[model samples]
Target: MQPSSSPSKFDNMPGDIERRPSVEEALDHEPLEKGWWYKPHVLKLNFLMLAPFVTMAAWGFDISMTNSLQSLEAFNERFDHPSGARLGFYGASTQLGGAFTIFVAPFIIQKLGRRAMCLIGSSIIIGMSIMQTFALNFNMFVAAKLLLGFGSTGVQIAAPVLITELAHPRQRERITAMYNTTIYVGLIAGAWIAFGTQDIPGDRSWQIPTILQVVLPAYQVLTIFLCPESPRWLVAKGQEEKARKILVKYHGGGQETPLVRAEMEAIMAGIEADATRIRFNKTDISALLSHKGNLHRILIATVVAVGSQCTGSGLISAYLPQILDNVGMTSTREKTLINGIINIWTWIIGLGAGYVIPKLSKRSLFLFSTSGMILTFVVWTALSAVYTQQGGYSYGIGVVAMMFIYNAFYGMCWLPLVVAYPLELATTKQRGILFSWMFFCLSMSTFAVNYINPIGLENIGWRYYIITIVFTLLILCLIYFFFVETKGLSLEEVATVFDGRENYDAAVSAVHAVEVKQAGEPEEQHVERKDER
Candidate 1:
């Protein structure tokens, strides 16, 4: 509501298009909205937002468990001591499976909706995980995990997009950024279980740890039924009444408050405005390439996706046992313990970064992370060179410290924003397409480095850090020039960063303007408007 002494700051502007306080800002100033976040409906909204943690944790658990398994003597003996190319295939199998089905995820999300995609993905993971846990042969085990990757890609595509499109406007940024932190939770759990089970007899040591991986995905399948579909997705499918009801129940405390109306109005306006520009259920690949603003988004998505895996993580994350061996450490138990500790460290860093992300721009976050990595790699490379030539124990210790420092920077930016950045930058229809491309690209990059990391580490030793240092510099340059500021803006407001202000839909703030007109007068609270689509 406007104060009596002053006109809106936009009063002198030339166009009839209006600008108003964001609904989030207005809600903060409203006396009626005190303790708003603690309300029961908003709590329920947060629970729905938290439901995807199981899906994220599942990925973390798999990566950590697989990493620990490589160091286990029983598992190696059970599988006939897989080494060289066979071991590389063991790590690359899931990624290879992702390459097969990643592009199809967007099509399913576009047709059946994001909720449907989550359900289907969880169900597939559940089946494949059971197969993985009970497989009688190594070939059967690899086949089961390969199919599991096929399913994980679907949830990976939908979960972040759900948080992006459905969270309450004020909670969206932090929640979406924190969304990936759940993966670290999974990683920590996996590490603890594998370390604890190290002394168990025979195959149970590994099998028991693998069985726990299935539990999180099964939990997601059950909880997803209790949550509402994305209001934006609902609106795109001509289900405006359903979208409004869901928003009123959750975002408005079961009433059409000004905040709720403002958000709904913005969603309707954005969709209606983009209707001519996008076909809601159709594939957006061609549409995205044809549009200048969207194409720029795709380029950033590629940089983020490819840069995330390519930036020296491959050697540390999956091959830490080998790295430790090169540094003259040789206890299997010690290696397992170190694996657990590193993940705990990563989880702590992930939470800290997620909490702070809302206060800074996305561009600021990525630039800081990439720059830190560049410096870490340069020092790390020099340390490795010294340890290899001079054979000093102190040089080896310094190299290990540098690995932890490098991942701290990686977790600060890449772990959280890998998906969050692209989803926020996308238009409604572009969400699914952007996620598919990002994950597909991520899979391909991970696959490349999975093979390259072991061979490079064995052949050239520490010189592999040189390649990482150079590639990461290019990533930092792209982020500084391309990533835009989107600290507190709603999804519609974000379009202005890519598309110029005049080119964005002016209808976004029109309903808020109408509310400003009736601010002081006693009138109905509901700002009723049709869905226009």
Candidate 2:
């Protein structure tokens, strides 16, 4: 099939088309059973298959390392560095590896099923763990981290797609949140482990954290091996019967055959329908940019992805130990404890937001969350500087207040919302490429920030957050000015919105009209994710 170039599609689909499912019609349907959460077999399978995602504990392996020695002077002496430059280099390199992963992921996803991809990711992490545990020098350690970054990319790309495919429509956001939550769980786990082990005076003390990294991925591998393949992947591979069996087993009511069949049929229909209208070679970045609407969606996705990392999460996380020491939380153990707790609790908040997200209009959530981040940056920037400069107890309180609110708001709003928006906004035909470009932009932005944060600290001190604050404000303004609310809208309906000739209300009306004929069921059907579909 010839790839649909950008200009043709963009010319065909203009903005200003308003399209939404009828609230009443949507309300009339009963919620999909939340039984998957309670189903022991399915839950077991989910946990196992998702192990690679949960194994993100490695990201925090360096948290306590920063806190190992007493003061920055002491840390510098032990590491034989006048500054934390070595550590900063390590972090930036790791994130740079993530950027490489984004460039390679589309082909990887196409060639390998989600399960295989996840397993391979876990294996890469495991190998990197060994490399880290046995590292003889700085270069080896950095290389190990780079490998971990690559492995982590596999998990990052596959986990959301897998969870979205397996989860009931109502629970989609929650499941995705669970994926993020597991990442924090790993972080918290790593922190606690680091604290528990950092006191050892031997050269191998750091090895404890590196060695511990192996456990999560190891566990993930053992557990995931027993889980069923993604039904969507199964269908894609022409294993319809096996896909139905697995779907029925996990989806409850023991009578999911019909639902599975319906889902499969819908998926096939959707594929056929989409194929007839749009064609693209997955590898061609230019093909992705060919459609005006597709081009616009890619831009939006890229902006959102880049904006996510610019929020200063990486800055705070990388510098947590340093920041904590500045605030009189001098005990490495205490700092580790606090770090662990923050990661865990923030994850809980993210998970909570996910639970309620499906009910909110995507527009409302996006606006609210984007605004919340801007507010957080404002407060955090002010308080972080005050705490850093003034030696007042009130300033300390301000720092804590800002950190707490920042974590809460970030977890609840941006974490899952950013991811969900891109996936929902893109047409299936372009989903992989759009997401690839999104992650690519994210990795690039993240690497840039990681590299620059240290420079910011050395040159500007705590005032560096001001840069992020400006970006945060722009994020909200951009959402308000350029983005459209895409809540519960079908892809076709969303496509109709970008045809700029129509007025906003008129476009929406057109979307409403197109949706009845073109939109069949929500994309949550049991076998809906199958390859054919």
Candidate 3:
């Protein structure tokens, strides 16, 4: 929240034509909120929110993995056989690549800004797609997968911030949902494309689907150049004036300009006020860890992220076709098609749930999702045991039903909530850093899950489901005690909630006041960009 003294000074202050700091200044004083989503420029930026799905499509790349595994086998014949260690890297590279991006994104955002960083990532994706098409050996394949993972990480971290920056509070959930929805769309698309290309004879089959992956990122690169840089970031660097012009361009006409300007000025006053109170330094682990509240928020974020990955979702996804094959599926193509159908419906329902979450208590929704996971795991464990006991077509059919049901429930709950929770918790100043680190932990968890699955299934018999079920129950306990409701709250309000310094109502009101103040202000006229400053 803005310091008490700062708001009092601005409460009755005169609007000056020349004294206002840039957009960055105001945002630095206040925080980005729901109201900002209403501006035209901000709204237009939502189109690029589709980028996450593009990254997520890589997850569904496994739709054709059976074919790829065959291709891997064929490629290995002329060369050395890829070890489990090496093969593990291929599976884990996507998340490992994500970790690399998480570690680097904060610094990159600090240097190039979010817009430039997103564009660079998009370029890497397009380049990686081309490279993957030509990879001949396991090492080259690993390099291609790593590059693709890094590119996806850029999208994963940047998309939500972009949407949060560009959207109004009323539209935030919907806009964010668009990003989440597109990812599922990407998954479905990857499944169908890879599925369709499965029988084209030789390595040429994989090339088509791999090359098709470049289309979305290439479009994102083009779009980023046309879109405005984030107004929040602009405000942070003292580019108040530029930020204002963009706001005006987005708002159009003068109808809302004065109100927007007033909010901007108030925001600037608050930021300038806060700047006077604190030291300026690059955001880092030390800064975040030094504060107890921030530490709590980080712990919550890490657990949520890790939990999302640990629910056995990645394991189910990686081995879907193989699972189907085990369950007596007739053909790979048929299985991929059925899998795509399940995924599409699952996401459609999941997106629906995410849309409603903002209206419901975040805590309640978190509990509900956690409960669904617990139930899903219980069922999964029972089904695994049943299949072990019976071992026939009946058990295989039961396995199919269990798989479909798990994906359906999972997509509706865990998928969106995991991403939504972290985005809703962190402060604007710490968001990029927090989300990146969250993704880092998520990637690490993914690496562990994917690496352990082959070994676990081969060595443990039927113990994997039992182990995962236990984690789901533990996560449910975490949600009940530590997680707070963030629905309808602005980012700054979320910051307050995490800090535990104020009552829920008061903290939310404080954040709302700050956001409304920022939204209603006009952009400052002569502020410097980060580079210029």
Which candidate ranks first by TM-score, i.e. highest?
1
Alpha-carbon deviation at 450 in model 1, angstroms: 1.4
lDDT of 3 by residue, 342-420 (tens): 6677778777877776677867866776677668667766666666677677766776677677776677657777677
Candidate lDDT scores, in order, read 0.77, 0.60, 0.62
Better of 1 and 2 by lDDT: 1
Per-model TM values vs. the true structure: 0.90, 0.79, 0.80
What TM-score does model 2 achieve against the real structure?
Answer: 0.79
Which residues of candidate 1, in runs, are more than 4 Å off? 1-21, 30-36, 276-287, 509-533
Model 3 stretches with alpha carbons more than 4 Å out: 1-45, 48-86, 251-254, 257-284, 500-533
Give a tens-digit lDDT track for model 2, residues 1-533: 22332222112333333333232233234344664466575566556555544544444443333333222232334446534565566657666777777656666665566667677777887998888777776677778878787787766676566655565443555565455555566566666766666656665556776677777677766665565665655654456678767766665335553444344443332332232122234655455455566666766787788777887777666667656655666665666677767777787887788777766676666677767766877876676677777676677667656776778877776776666677766544445556667777877887787778776776776677788888878777777766777655433335445533133233333333343335564433312112210
What candidate 2 gets wrong by more than 4 Å, as runs, is 1-49, 52-78, 82-85, 234-242, 252-258, 276-283, 325-334, 384-390, 427-429, 482-533
TM-score (C-alpha, index-matched) for candidate 1: 0.90
Clashing pairs in 1: none
lDDT of 1 by residue, 358-461 (tens): 88877888888899999998999998898889898888788789989998999998988887888888777667877888888988888888767777778888
After TM-score superposition, what is the CA distance of residue 316 in candidate 2 from its true location, in Å?
1.6
**Better candidate by TM-score, 1 or 2:** 1
Which of candidates 2 and 3 reaches a greater lDDT?
3
Tell how far residue 326 is off in model 3, in angstroms.
4.2
